[model samples]
Target: MSDFIEQLSPLHTVEREEITKAFREVFALSAGKRVLFWMLEQAAIYQDAFAGEATNSTNYTLGRQSAGRRLIEMLDAVDPRFYPALLIAIADLKTIDLAAAESLAKQQEGEEYDVEA
Candidate 1:
């Protein structure tokens, strides 16, 4: 991962350390929970953008593009171990059905809990 880190724009030592620390924290989260959080965050952006009748198509499109960029940034920052879960979450996002995505996440969370028990 050093190669991956080196490819990023240069950062001050403290800034680099902080980023590494943050990544460690994110990496510590259960994979399923991380995927669920990502789904909910994307859903929130869609809900906010489309909440009002006054919202224009342009605004909605911009919101979606912004959310997609953020998702890409998150995928880059996360550990490789989370890739499978992330891919699954991305697939659910493509369905454009927030309720179904949420249900899937909940089901995964339950399965994770059962495995732990």
Candidate 2:
């Protein structure tokens, strides 16, 4: 549909097949890959929006935060290999502190606060 295409055009750069392959390679899908797939796509969508022409600063910041949140969500659901890649990507979006992810996990586990850099 034209409306659907128009809405999605700015939020996607990679082709569908490429994205599918990326999902397969990164997620390995059997072990909680669905959530990873969803989060990765969400992050990509936000990045795409931020990268689009005529995009405003507000939209860019919103998209970056959306991507960051999705990456954080993926940290909980995805593989260990995913974490550092996500940290870099999140940092590229201007979010600092990969340790926040670890801290959040520890907080959830009711562990004593030991913030690592």
Candidate 3:
């Protein structure tokens, strides 16, 4: 009994419960949402590692291509329906402009409300 308990005690029960809870949260999300968030996180990592002052260099291009290939491989493991949404989300993330987004938000705040229209 002691040996059996020791063999299974690598992760304490509390740690296992925490891991189970994290998995449940991930499982609760729609497949598309999961893929979108995963791709966005991957993109940020790639940008930080490869899209710096040498972004236009050949090495950067190669690194970006490799990261894109890995992203596609990851997407292939999930439902096909999520592919388009994930692609669009990643593209939008890549092209997003913070300044333009802030300006647009400010412009909308000054607009009159037109719920009936």
Candidate 4:
């Protein structure tokens, strides 16, 4: 095997500490505000997926399917070609951004403001 191929191994395991440091270093080299905004977007997607129309449609449903089939279902909402990886992963987030979600709902309704003043 070539030198490059000799060192390459699929069994390589990255330590948690090293992964954390690498993640932080990557973000530090770029803009923090953009990442923050990206986080908000992920939160909105999460809210819509878990609490909005998406959730309602799939609620109280039980079925069994292979992991590949489930992946295709998630891909329906998010295109893997565009978003291969999230800036701030939200699929496993415990909470949603209510403010961001509310704003998204309003934008979809074509109403500027619904507050009665």
Candidate with top lDDT is: 1
Clashing pairs in 2: none
Q: What is the C-alpha RMSD of each candidate to the true structure, in Å?
A: 10.8, 13.9, 10.1, 13.5
Cα displacement (Å) at residue 97, model 1: 18
Report, for every candidate in turn, its global Cα lDDT versus the true structure. 0.62, 0.55, 0.57, 0.42
Q: Kindly list the per-residue Cα lDDT of model 3 for residues 37-65, writing each as its tens digit.
A: 67555555345455457757657567655
Q: Give the candidate number with the greatest TM-score.
A: 1
The regions of model 2 sitting more than 4 angstroms off are 1-31, 45-53, 57-80, 83-117
Higher-scoring candidate on lDDT, 1 or 4: 1
Clashes of each: 0, 0, 0, 0
Order candidates by TM-score, high to low: 1, 3, 2, 4
Candidates' TM-scores? 0.37, 0.26, 0.33, 0.25
Model 4 regions lying over 4 Å from their true place? 1-14, 43-117
Return the candidate ranking by lDDT, descending: 1, 3, 2, 4
Per-residue alpha-carbon lDDT of candidate 4 for residues 1-117, written as tens digits (9 for 90 to 100): 257545755544334335445544543443432453354444343232333566544442212123323533343333453133333333323135566777789797866466558
Per residue, candidate 2 scores C-alpha lDDT tens digits across 1-117 of: 557546665447246446546654755443334455455555554354554565686586677668767665545443455655554454543343456776787787775445455
